[model samples]
Target chain A: MDNSDFKGKNILIVGLGLMGCSFADAFRDLYPQKIYGFDINKEITNYAQQKGLIDEGLTKINSAILGECDFVMICLYLDDAVQFICKNMDGFKKGCIITDIVGVKRKIVSSVQEVLRDDIDYIPGHPMAGKERQGFGYADKKIFKGKNYILTPTKFNKSDNVDYLEKIIKAIGFENVVYTDPEKHDEKIAFTSQLCHVIASSMVDINVDDDISNYEGGSFQDMTRIAMINSKMWSELFIANKDKLVNVLDNFLTSIESFKMLIEKEDPKLIDKLDIIKKSRESL
Target chain B: MDNSDFKGKNILIVGLGLMGCSFADAFRDLYPQKIYGFDINKEITNYAQQKGLIDEGLTKINSAILGECDFVMICLYLDDAVQFICKNMDGFKKGCIITDIVGVKRKIVSSVQEVLRDDIDYIPGHPMAGKERQGFGYADKKIFKGKNYILTPTKFNKSDNVDYLEKIIKAIGFENVVYTDPEKHDEKIAFTSQLCHVIASSMVDINVDDDISNYEGGSFQDMTRIAMINSKMWSELFIANKDKLVNVLDNFLTSIESFKMLIEKEDPKLIDKLDIIKKSRESL
Candidate 1:
């Protein structure tokens, strides 16, 4: 299927939460077609429908209703993603490309593939954009305006399916798209995303009891800006992808230990190491 | 002396680093008068003079010349602050109010006071402002704009001297001015400034080899932003304020250990703890 195949197609966004509702709004605005939504919470689903984020709101995913949709986008919790895919297998149409907004792709992709038939192609994608504030009210149309959209499509996936998903993502106003292996994507995220949340959380916890109301400067604010992210969601996501997170954490702890040793020794050579890191940070 | 005392007063800024030069620029622009500067490196002093960051830059402090100055603002390395005051004690006037922009005051405030005569009041003040980029060239005139300026003046400091420093800091564009004890100031900075630097440096060192140019987003950049701080300068500062920094490090490490435990157990209960910290972070 080409870009024109998406022109009049029906799209279903499961889970009417922040990412789900955002997906519906983005596709509905750009695709010039109907966008449906499903969520466990009827209130959210109805609200999204009223706000024109979705054309239809459903409390349950039924085969009769989902069979009408050309594409299904799973926007659920990391751990719950595989379960949702398994339960809603019969709802998707034949040859429809399924994709996800899950942060980590390694396990979710594999688990989804295990349950779905070979005829149904699945392409995993993660939009590297979000805010500390969640919910449909906080969902922004400009969230992916200039963000990178990584498409993790396996060899089993057809070229047409990958192309179809890419067109949809591009139409949604994402600035860049990269096709990467699922394992590599998870590793990149471990260093870039998971490690960042851990460091912010750690820093915030360090000054948990301190009376820093009037003392904190811009640097502290900038560093801990993401500390307000939903911890329940983050903690779930953290453990769901534990192996990579643990590896990244080990690398971070080792570097910090070396720095502490340098500080303890009052060694001037610490500057050499810091200069190397500083150069890299600046380059990035 | 009152706020009007600074109208024609000659001021000496005793360091020409980023914060020092920024202080000079901030004050020089607002004071509309002569500002003298001294640095161990003649180049920095000369640069400050050439850049108009200071009116007079000198390699040596001459008592006859310095005695004419009304206020001496010491902005130097924490370790060298006491030595600087001691060596230049004979150069300053009898009733001159000596203030500092040092980070750790509990570490050196008493030592600095010990070197100065009773007639010369020492008010330990730390202006919570600066940029990662160092030197006089990167010094911005509005570095202190809307930022907090903290004055940790001891009881021995005259009320007029404290008020004068406050007025000067406010005139330089600081929106908030806070007063606290020296020991409390050091403890607060240990948590906010020192521990944050260590965390940032360590986190950056973790992915120093990663190709972060493409995948690193806002969160990763924010987490490691302060890793660009001068290691030589921070190394000296850490050792100079070893006791307080070490204490803060211990507490920080303890918090990190708690996080590691949360990960190990994959406990959902830890979200409550994270929620409390996140709320505290938002309030700050």
Candidate 2:
């Protein structure tokens, strides 16, 4: 493998939505090569090309273009991304390294490994970066700057491929690149990312009937800011990591129940719980 | 009662903590009168007086200074505020209107009404404004600006007394002074204020073992901002409003359970729940 330069290499980005376009925008200056994009939405593809975020926009998936690419990044939803790879696995060039930026990792890693050709590399990557809003209009190259990027590689992945992917991530401005097994990545994210959204959404759902505008303070606003979520994307992610998410959700409910019990009994232990939480937060 | 000029009137503020000093700082420019302050912590009283947030600092709860005040504001914890008022009920000037900025209203209102002299009026007030930090050091006059000020006045409260308290709240720069009964105040606050803290604390408690700094985003920060709470103050508020807080907590847990069930079943209804939360947040 030529590790010296990727200046003339071709990179194809599947799904020209926020994450895909963001990757194109971030890599455009670093790669110094052709950036091609494909989206199910023709308008997004056209916009990406017009905005110069990509060198070429694929109206239809073409094997010739796919076969010529040195790198492939799939940014579609979990199901679409898996199906796209399985359906077009033949189109990928030999030794080409493919990656993704999906929230969930274990399922995608398993699916990709199931049908992946021995010559090709599939490295599952997740960038802990996003906004509550979506679409290409909100895409920005700076989204990945200083953000944490996790790479979950199975036994099928080659060390050279992982190193190349890390170099690409670094070139795109990610300061922290962590390597973790797929299961650990999914479990930790269930608490850090998915659980917070569930709590925010639940908080918002209950206060919908109340005239909260008149009496809400900073705490309420902070807790519910993420309640304005992208439903379709989140639902897919939630379902993809159901076991871990459900476990975290159950543990969260247990914590809340303990609080309720303390309050119900008017127990002095309530202060201890608060102190524990405060101390935990200080550690963060 | 003369409503025209309060220039010659005296105002006594008990508990020279954040809320008390904040009221004094906010009201100093609005009311042309002597603002006296008293706290169990004599140092806070002295500091408040030295900072000119209060005109006179009471070393002890003297009846002479208390009898001359036309308005009294109590800013103590639920139990302490109740005990202080009951202990000093006879020291207050005749026909003076007393108010409080306690988070929970029902318990305080009931306690005050039970021991308050007929010559004095008690109106329960709660300013929906605060920071996670405590004490007079964090006090700021602008904390109340444009924030909601709720007055939970029962039938025992005189109409004129409610109007007079509203004027004081307005003078403190609160634009929205809402009037509701004590029960309603407790119920709404359980959802809007108290429950948020509980959710934040619980979220912090669960993620304590995880190294969140590596992957945390804006949502995590926003959700846990209130986790750095004043343990004693919040525990008291949670206990005082236990029934209401527990009710809201139960409903919130049910909402979480519903989300969990949807995720467990991989139901499409999860999207609908997310949309509902998103729409509700937009209303705010």
Candidate 3:
């Protein structure tokens, strides 16, 4: 339990799709004692083991397998993660530290923390990384490089456990570890992640012939690349964080409407407005 | 005049800005008789000569320089280009072919064609290439690689001159050449280029703290990269093409509003909508 290098630590990865398999691939480099993967899909489970991403694979969750792991990553959809953790609270080893890679924080963390065990620590996590295409077939450890791993630590989480999680994340190719409260994490993510996908999807849905790309420069390609989306997962995240996202959308509308008027009137002030935006964009 | 190789042609690059300097850099590889650059900024004109981007430099246009050139590329602002062409119409050598690199076609082409010299062929063009930064210092010929060059040929344009342009553009690294009428060019370019810029600028103008980028994945970065705006240039293009751009913006608002409602109601229909968007996006 005191091993900070993750040596001799048994790790469990639930829902072995992109995030789970990718995590398993990274943990192999850390030399964990065992990396066990569980998924409802037998094909993916066998595939992960065959690819050497996992040392063992489970098609179903069993207490014996779960009780041996020192850490776990619940890489399921938000509501499913809540259900999985709540239903199997007794299965995890004592003093085990678990995390999830779902994008939204408030809903999943609130639901799971409502009925979590005192003997184990669950630190809410969001790795700010993904691809437009989903599933294990597209999984690669390279996606995690230069990305951030956000940890929203609540009162129930121990300081040592949070530090250990950060250490493992850095080892797994994340460039930085960010700390925030659950509410603030959701708010920021709604703007940076969810709002961007929403805009890209809308741009594509405007229904211009795709041949219109013939006239495009790199900017249009960059702006709309994420319109190729994971529909089910993103739809769920958008709804769960609807309040913050819609508010951000409204602020965006106000800014664009002003631009509409400036263009309509051929206003000289638009130069100033765009200059301000340029400076703001550079600040990022 | 019939040589598609540009072997004996003197090419004049007007304005000596990003596009003009970059064009000069590309034309260097074609071994034109000479590349002459004209700019109000003496520093830039001298820099182009020093860098060997232009074989010769002119601080101001003249009948001596204009009369000898077999081809010209007007890289000035749309309004300035109209003025320059009108004032110098009589100076261009007979049968000299001229073109422009303006983003908006209808306004500039209409203004120039009204007073254009019949002896010289003037073709309206748009190179679907640029960078977020402007000016001669940032100019690089590599931007033209794997990009498109669009020519909106009018009845006034001679087919032979347009053919020569296609040859030159291909030699200078344009991957494709698209032909459209000036009006259709304006309409389609409004959506593909101008509207995308408007969206990126509005996203930046939303005024969130720059630190919000800490939570961003690449999607947000991609969506907002063009918000590092050439304020004066883009605001002018937006206003010049306002009617068409405003109409396109309305269509986008309608599409995004539907997304907002779907998110608000937590509608299952959102999954269907996003799937459609994903397919549409893939077409590009």
Writing each residue's lDDT as its tens digit, candidate 1 over B1-284 gives: 67633577788888778877887777765564578898878888888888878888888877877888888888787777778888877777889888888777776787877776888888888888878887767878687889888888887888977887788788878889999988777777777788788878777777745567457557877777888887666777776666777777777666766776777778776788778878877877
lDDT (10s digit) by residue, model 3, range B125-161: 9999988888899999899999988999889888888
Give candidate 1's whole-model lDDT.
0.79
Docking class of 2: medium
Give the CA lDDT, 0 to 100, for residue B214 in model 3: 78
Per-residue lDDT of model 1, residues A1-284, tens digit only: 67633577878888877788777767766664678888889899889988888888898877887888778888888877789888888767887778888888888988887788777888898888888877888876678787788988888899987877787687788777888888888888888888888777777877755557577577777777888888777888777777788788777776766766776787788778878777777776
DockQ, prediction 1: 0.58
Best by lDDT: 3
What's the TM-score of every candidate structure? Answer: 0.94, 0.91, 0.98
Model 3, residue A11: displacement in angstroms?
1.1
Candidate number with the higher lDDT (2 or 3): 3
lDDT of each: 0.79, 0.86, 0.88
Give the DockQ (C-alpha) for candidate 2: 0.66
Highest DockQ model number: 3
Q: For each candidate, report what fraction of the true interface contacts it reproduces.
A: 0.61, 0.84, 0.86
For model 2, the superposed segments whose C-alpha errors exceed 4 Å read A1-6, A155-164, A167-173, A208-210, B1-9, B155-164, B208-210
Quote model 1's iRMS.
2.0
lDDT score at residue A2, model 1, on the 0-100 scale: 77
Clashes of each: 0, 0, 0
Best by TM-score: 3
Ranking by DockQ: 3, 2, 1
